[model samples]
Target: MAAEDPSVSGVSGRYATALFELARDERSIDAVKADLDQFEAMLADSADLKRLVRSPVFSADTQLKALAAVLEQAGITGISANFLKVVTANRRLFAVTGVIRAFRALVAKFKGEATADVTVAETLSDKNLDVLKAALKSVTGKDVALNVKVDRSIIGGLVVKLGSRMVDSSLRTKLNSIKHAMKEAG
Candidate 1:
């Protein structure tokens, strides 16, 4: 089980670190992770919700109260909702979405999960995903948890990104690289 240091970076890192510590203290790491995932999904699906959180024009009170209602109706815990209110009151709601993502990454780190963001041209089959996971585990020397994505512009093959590193086997990239090489040779 590889454990990452509490040390991450930027404003997002600070918010995530605080929330992660609280979750760890309450031994509700799993539940908090789930709640954050749900929050991310809601933010992604609702344009108005995204705007409300990111827009400075909305009063802190509006954000605080509206978010509280949503969290309460969703059966989220007091601490989670309280955190949102604090972010709102401080006018840090714009960081909320990134905080949730970073919190999940940190939680995964503490849980010994190797998170990889994988992008491909088409939706992958479970079998392909399993194979990819296995191959990634071998390469990374840790269990790999994938976040799959699609980019039709990939043309073919897949582009797997892990943190600052990437494996670009995409046909588009390959073609471009070849074209560059041919022009340079000529």
Candidate 2:
């Protein structure tokens, strides 16, 4: 199944499982997670890195050499450093982000924590953030660690998302509803 699978469907999970097993065997799960976090940050912060990873023209040798320099500059560990080199040598760098996320999910499972991505129109105060965290914990029955994002473009109110379900109560959404209602009434 691993050999014949198309990554378009369930790539991250597969790669994460493989990496997670390796980390578990080496007793470096925490270190690996931290390393992957750094790698993910690099992927986000460097457009050139993303472009380089996605570029098909770079031979595996060139990619591996470049990745080695990047790993050294970033102070990456032996496990993570070697993993990146292997990925580059095999031309699997494009899946770096997914692998990071998937590895995080695995780490969270091991830590007995749940990950919730929360986006709001504005930054919530720490007090409000705690309230939100408590509410989510009450519902999820697990320790929730939120990934918060602020988007001022949303105008007002909040959007709470837990997995696939979304509770959209933003001012933008309310205004759109009011507009739709007026048009229907007219």
Candidate 3:
């Protein structure tokens, strides 16, 4: 399952694989995925949660206590909640984001869908998202699930990573290339 994407490797991959197997066996793949998505969204939205997840200053016990509250508040119980608690107890809470991403990749593959990591200067509208999905679908011949991230540093345009291929059309890259060319000419 981890053969194609190198993102699913080492510590994160192993944990993700174990969670994936459990979700698959229990036939709660959708429930676990939704819970993980909620957790990821919370991590993105809350600075304190982000710190709790990424900072090693917090001991395992503190992280566990904090994570328990978070899971309960988010109503993310069952296998997904257990998985998070296990990760925290193992002192691998720092890599939870990667594990979630890897788990999403596994689910996407299992469903015969291709997952694309897309970065844009701003959030794309629903219409634009549907158009991009259609375009990617045409290319990959599979339904594409987009993981969209916003980075203002891109200035404009977007960058897409599909499997081993990446298309970087961001304004930052374009400007950098032009600057490099002028330097070479000078």
Query: What TM-score do all the candidates reach, one by one?
Result: 0.80, 0.78, 0.93
For candidate 3, lDDT tens digit of each residue in 39-66?
Answer: 9999999999999999999999999999
Give the deviation of candidate 1 from the true structure as CA RMSD. 3.3
Count clashing residue pairs per candidate: 0, 0, 0
1-186: candidate 1 lDDT, tens digit per residue: 113443356777888888889889989888877787777778777898899888988898888888888888777765677777787888999988778767868877887887898989998999999999999989888888787778899999999987678999999999999999999999
Lowest-sum lDDT 10-residue window in model 2: 1-10
User: Which pairs of residues collide in model 2?
Assistant: none
lDDT of each: 0.82, 0.79, 0.95
Tens digits of per-residue lDDT, candidate 2, 39-145, equal 87787679888888889988889888888888899999688888778777777877877777777667767777777777788879999999988998898899887
* Candidate 3 ranges with C-alpha deviation above 4 Å: 3-5
TM-score of 2: 0.78
Which whole-number lDDT from 0 to 100 does residue 180 have in model 2? 100
Which residue pairs overlap in candidate 1's backbone? none
Q: Looking at model 3, which ten-residue stretch has the lowest summed lDDT? A: 1-10
Query: Candidate 2: misplaced stretches above 4 Å?
Result: 1-9, 121-131, 149-152, 156-158
